[model samples]
Target: MRVAIVTESFLPALNGVTTSVCKVLESLRAQGHDALVIAPGTSPWSPTMTPEHYAGFPVHSVTSVPVRQFRVGLPSYEIETVLHRFRPDVMHVASPFVLGVRGLTAARALGIPSVAIYQTDMPSYIRQHSGPAGDLTARAAWRWIRRIHQQADLTLAPSSAALQDLAAHDVPRIAQWGRGVDSDLFHPARRTDPGTAALRARLAPRGETLLGYVGRLAPEKELHRLVELARVPGTRLVLVGEGPSSEMLAASLPGAVFLGRREGEDLARAYAAFDVFVHTGTRETFGQTIQEAAAAGLPVVAPARGGPLDLVEVGVTGDLFDPDRPGDLAAKVAPLVGPEAAELRERMGLAARDRVVTRSWPALVEQLLDHYALAIRDFSRSVA
Candidate 1:
């Protein structure tokens, strides 16, 4: 089957959506299926890709602008011509926003069956970064999202929680489609790598514990709460991504180390450097970084909300703190570290890695392909 994927995020823009699409595309082609990508890219657009990068797949790179608030693509249109040439059996929208909306609209007009994945919790994000009246803006965004996703033959949610949220929004034809991690790339062994060791020394020369957060440095991340961790002596807080919040975060958390953004092996090693992997984003629809952290064998501490609830097994793999409780995050993390805590931390880290083994990409991709086939059949029957 031929599939066309349209997403606002893509390569060179490090985030969950871009990485998820790249992984999906690679898996699709390996299974003897052709895939076409429509995503935002640099100034010079390319119709065809080189085998060296992106598996040499056909990608329609659109000229794009940076979203004012966040460091993500807001692609301008040209999806129609790409869709015309590719003529795919089905379309997949990786969180329909600027570019995805165009691709979905074109697919509907061309009578092509499409599937949309609710990768981001946009309404929650709006409430995060949109200042006062944020709640109202988020409500409005949810309605807009519902209107767009209902056009698809199927809407895939990463978690049951997300599906429930979508159902409340009255978006039909929804199903579960979770994220996966590469354990091979992010294993416990990497913790001892020369580069990772060097990083650990650089970040915490005084033997301070490293509490790390990986992903976009956006307002929605609620990094301000990390200040609470700073109060815990003999520990250093590090952020591993770049965004509009970089300046604000650096200013607010002066003691925290900002590693900018790291990808590929560098990213994996960065994960290994953390003594504890912490997630600050309470609104995450699916925490890919949390999965990666688990794969890296780092004990996680996250809010008892959204995606982490699906990933972290309390007291088994990692601990989940109540988002509503004061100092709940600190209390949960307190037990995972300190002089008397090494044994417990190691046990939990190993457990975390073990749990991530079950979320295999091949299985997830096959499931996605099955969804594509089902969506196509349903679409054909309805159109007939």
Candidate 2:
């Protein structure tokens, strides 16, 4: 099968959308399917570098303009031209916003089926970044999101909470499709690896419990929630990524250890070194990092909202805290920390690993192909 993926972010951008798109492209290549990427051109974030191809597939960069810290792809005649040449079996639109809307329109013009993947929680993000006009802007963002997904042959949401949100907004033809983790890369064995153990000792010199959080250190992530955990006795907060809010978060989270950005083996080591994985973000459509931590054999502590609701088995794998209640996060985390709770943490970590062990990228990609087949059938029927 030939697939054309039009994404809002890709390559040099290290976010959830980019990571998932890369995995899909790799899977498509391994399965002997042809695929290509359409993404924004080089941006301020990585102005000096942008790959021409990835995973042996061509990456066509469209003209883009900077929007705050990231680049936003503009509507281009190049999209239709590229589609006309490739003549894809189906179009995969990832996190459709400006570029995605154009891709869907082009697919319709060429009589091609398109699948829109809903990855980000734009409404909540708008509310977080839009200042006093937050609520109003968020509503407008929802309207735009609804319009985009409504046009697709099928819309794929990453979690049940996200699926319900789309259904509530009246977006049609929705299905739940979650992200997968690399169990081989992020495994329970990494905890004892020499490098990981050394790193863990450095972070928790006095045998303090390491509670880690991975992902961008941005405002929307709600990292400030970690302040309560920071004050917890016998616990140390370890942040594993960098973003616009890095300096501010560092100042606010005094005792926290910030490990700028770690990828591949380094990232896996960081996760393995932690006693518990804590995700403070309340607005995630799907918490990909939570899955990584689970695969690394660490119990999770996340808000009882969004994607965590589907991932954490509460008590069995990890615990969930009420995002609305003050100190609830620290309270939820207390049970899994300290030397007294070592046995409980180990049991929960093993259970966490068990939950995600079967969810490899290839298996999830096969499910994605099933969604693509459904889209093709639906599109064919609509025209008939």
Candidate 3:
């Protein structure tokens, strides 16, 4: 099938949405299907920049605004024209915000099957950014989001919990379209890298337990609570990512190591070097970093909320503590710092790796194609 993907985020800016879009496009090319991407980019045509291509497929780079210190493209005016020429069998939109909203509308006008992946927890994010008055803004955003999504053939949520939230909000045609991890890139084998040892040593001086957190250093992530984790005796909090929240987080989390965004082998080493992975984001639709940590053989200690609830297997793959309960995070992670630390760490780490073995990109893309076929069939039936 020819798929037209209009995304809010893409290359030159790294995040879960960018990573997932690249993976899907790669899979589409490998399976001999036509796919095109429309996203915001940092001047691939600029004098300093070399062109950015994904799996030999062309990307229609457009202008976008900065969100969480990254560029998020507004929908292009030429999208309808582009879709007209491509005549896509389906339209797959990632985080149906600006670009996606337009893409879904065009898909309807063109009478094509379309699916919108609800990735961001924008309602909660709006509240975080708006304070007490943001509730009205969040409600308005939700209504707008629901309006756009209701036009699509289907809405693909990243997890069951996320789908539940969408369903509760009266968004129809909700289904689960999960995320995948690169096992080869992020594996236990990468831990033996000399860089890994150097990183651990640098982050945790004098043999402090190295606890890691990956993803944007934003308020929505609730990273301020990381100060609480750092207070846990002999534990060092090492954050791997950059955001506007950096300076403030650094000032508050004194002595905690801020590696400021590591990618490729460096990112894998960062994850493997940590003793335990702690996630504080309660609004994640699909925690990509959590899966990457699991693949790197680090047991996760996440709040019992949102995407972590679906990804983490308590006591086996990781531990889940109720973040609503004060000190619950400390209580769950306490055992890892105790006398049986060695045994529990090894057991949890191994299980963490074992659990995500099937979460390969190929398997996920195949499942996605299945959904596309179903959506197409259902859409055709409805239109007929």
Against the true structure, candidate 2 reaches a TM-score of 0.98
Ordering by lDDT: 2, 3, 1
- What does candidate 1's lDDT look like per residue over 1-384, in tens digits? 989988877766667887899899888878888988877765444333212247557777676664663234454446777788889999999988777888788998888999999988989877777889998999999999998897889999998788889999999999999987888999889988999999999998998778889988877788777867866777889889998888988888878999987888999999999989999778988899999999999999998988888889999888998877878888888777675777887899899999887787877999999999999999999989
Q: For residues 110-209, could you state the per-residue lDDT of candidate 3 as single tens digits?
A: 8989988899999988887897789998998899889989988888998989999999899999899898899899998877889888877787668878
For model 2 the local lDDT of residue 381 reads: 92
Query: Which candidate number would show the highest lDDT if scored against the true structure?
Result: 2
Clashing pairs in model 3?
none
TM-score-based ranking: 2, 3, 1
Clash count for candidate 3 is 0
Provide the TM-score for each candidate, comma-separated.
0.93, 0.98, 0.95
For candidate 1, what is the total of clashing residue pairs?
0
Candidate 1 Cα outliers beyond 4 Å, as residue runs: 44-53, 69-77
- Provide the lDDT at 377 for model 2: 95
